[model samples]
Target: MTMAGTLYLIPNTLGPADAGAADPLRALIPDEVQAITAGLDCFIAENAKTTRAFLKLVALQHPLAKPLQEIQINELNVNTPEAMLPQLLQPLLEGRNAGLISEAGVPAVADPGANLVRLAHAQGIQVRPLVGPSSLLLAVMASGLNGQSFAFNGYLPVDAAQRGKQIKMLEERSRKEKQTQIFIETPYRNAALLETLANTCQPGTLICIATDLSLASESIVTRTAAVWKKQLAAGKAPDLHKRPTVFLFLGQ
Candidate 1:
């Protein structure tokens, strides 16, 4: 019987290629992770274009096992049907090692890749997670909030009235459970979300805005709702336009 291939869970940079250090890949990705990524020829990625870009960077550090054109990259998105999961896993079932990569940060968490990971497990494929940066964990660690118990509440509602109500609900839940509530917003709507968070949450509630994690333009600030309100009034809110960010709050 042929041995099944192992599935490697790879992580990509949090933002644009040049968003971070002079050598972003060297700085953000460990040597081992780069080496492993460079050796994989089969991958499941959110976007083939971005995966090729990531591979080019990895190639700079460690030469790829096969040419870029020869590598097989399959796309996986939210709209992918449940019945097609097995087909995506065919490479592994055929004894070819494959990597699972996300558009940003780690795979599976807050990504459609989670479905593939679950399917891999059910099919008895060995899944190995590589070490890398995660915006959620980085935000929680720097928030000065209750990291002991926290939850990542993906993206909040976009509508102002509905979002405000959802924010209050999350705040209330945080207060009762002494848990930190974490979420994100569409980049363009970040400023609006910050405004709503400052205005809707209680005065003493703490909110941490971590933007561009692992990037040169990174910013992580934890302040009370009252203080944030004051900043907003003074037009001192950080510029979060078109930047990836993670928002966390803990109600007192």
Candidate 2:
């Protein structure tokens, strides 16, 4: 019987591609990661185009054994059923190492690749996660909140009322349990989410806004909800619309 190959979890940069000397985001990705990626020929990714683009970037540091076109790429998305995951890992069963790459940041953290990781563990396959940038942990590190006990609440409800209710619950939990609450929103709706957060959370609640992490336009700030509201009222707050951001809430 062929021994099952290792499953590698690969990470990608957080922002838009910029191939220049000043591309700070590129520096966040480790050299070892690119080397490992160059050796792998099979991959399961969130988006094929983005994955291919990243592979090309990896090629700059280490030459790939096969042509980009010849490499096997399996697309995985939020809608992909659990049953189809086994097919993605078929290469590993054949004694060929396969990689799981996310659209950005670490794979399976807030991405849709968790199912495959779970399956790998059940099958007793070796799962290795390489070092890389993670927006969630970065936000917590900069927030000055209770990093010792924090919970990542992916995306709250989109509806105004429901979202507000969810925010209250998160704040209550943070206050009572002394846990930091982390969440995110679609880039386009970042401004709206900020507005809702300022209005819904209590005046003493601490809110951290972390945007464009590891990029040239990176910004991280923590303030009370009251202070944030005052900034918005005075037009002093930075624009967050259409930018990738992570929000953290800590109640007093």
Candidate 3:
């Protein structure tokens, strides 16, 4: 198959919301996933194992006629260019197009596909990105904060003191300008984040907790500092925190 000379950066909308929604964007994911398998001559993923697990879960609702490996390099079981750059770039160097797949969202936003993107640009290859779901973007959309101006601050420092200081700074920025602050934490440290926010943010600050989005347990709530404390303390813990959680705050 002749390549399109286009490198696709495809985002996987692997959430219950996208999987279950009737929205146009939601509907596009399954089609995109299928089309990439059939359309691309070669593809790259962040982690083949993670992608395989996601496909299986998606298959429960909609069986994939094509498995992921059908796209060349599937058998190689690699995702990052750091792992398969030379292999993927070989075909590209041969004038073939390649697709970049992150474990979840678009490559390089929060993943390791940056190297490939950089390399492709350096080599003068055309890069094309397809529309798909993103948990981080979704969290902010429903955060009810200053949508006009927000910063997607990635994971904060894991050390207790460092994390606390970072949270304090984020809180100050949001309060000073009413800008929304967004970030994520590892599963085990979610409650720790919640605890830090409860202690760091002001009493009346508005916090948005979007957990388990697009799954059977999908939940998103915009709450005040006081209310969130009571709910969490009363065992209304979020399952989203059990896996990956997006935390947004806009101090009032």
Best by lDDT: 1
The digit string of per-residue lDDT tens for model 3 on 155-223 reads 999888988898888888888988899988877888878877877678788888888766557678898
Instruction: Give candidate 1 regions above 4 Å deviation.
Output: 19-23
Candidate 2: lDDT of 53?
A: 87
Model 1 TM-score, 2 decimals: 0.96
Error of 3 at 82 (Å): 5.5
In order, candidate lDDTs are 0.92, 0.90, 0.70
Residue 49 displacement (Å), model 1: 0.9
Looking at candidate 2, what is the lDDT of residue 1? Answer: 93
Tell me how candidate 3 scores on lDDT: 0.70
Which regions in candidate 3 have their CA more than 4 angstroms from the true location?
A: 1-4, 15-33, 52-70, 74-87
Model 1 residue 209 distance off true place after TM-score fit, in angstroms: 0.4
- lDDT (Cα, tens digit) per residue for candidate 1, span 38-149: 9999999988899998998888779999999999999998878888899999999999999999999999998999989999999899999999889999999998999899
TM for candidate 2 is 0.96
Candidate 2 lDDT tens digits, 1-252: 999999999998887657654433357788888889999999999999999988888887789969999999999989899889888888898899988999999999999999899998988789999988999999999989998999999999988888989999999999999999999999999888888889989999999999999888999999999999999988887788888999999999
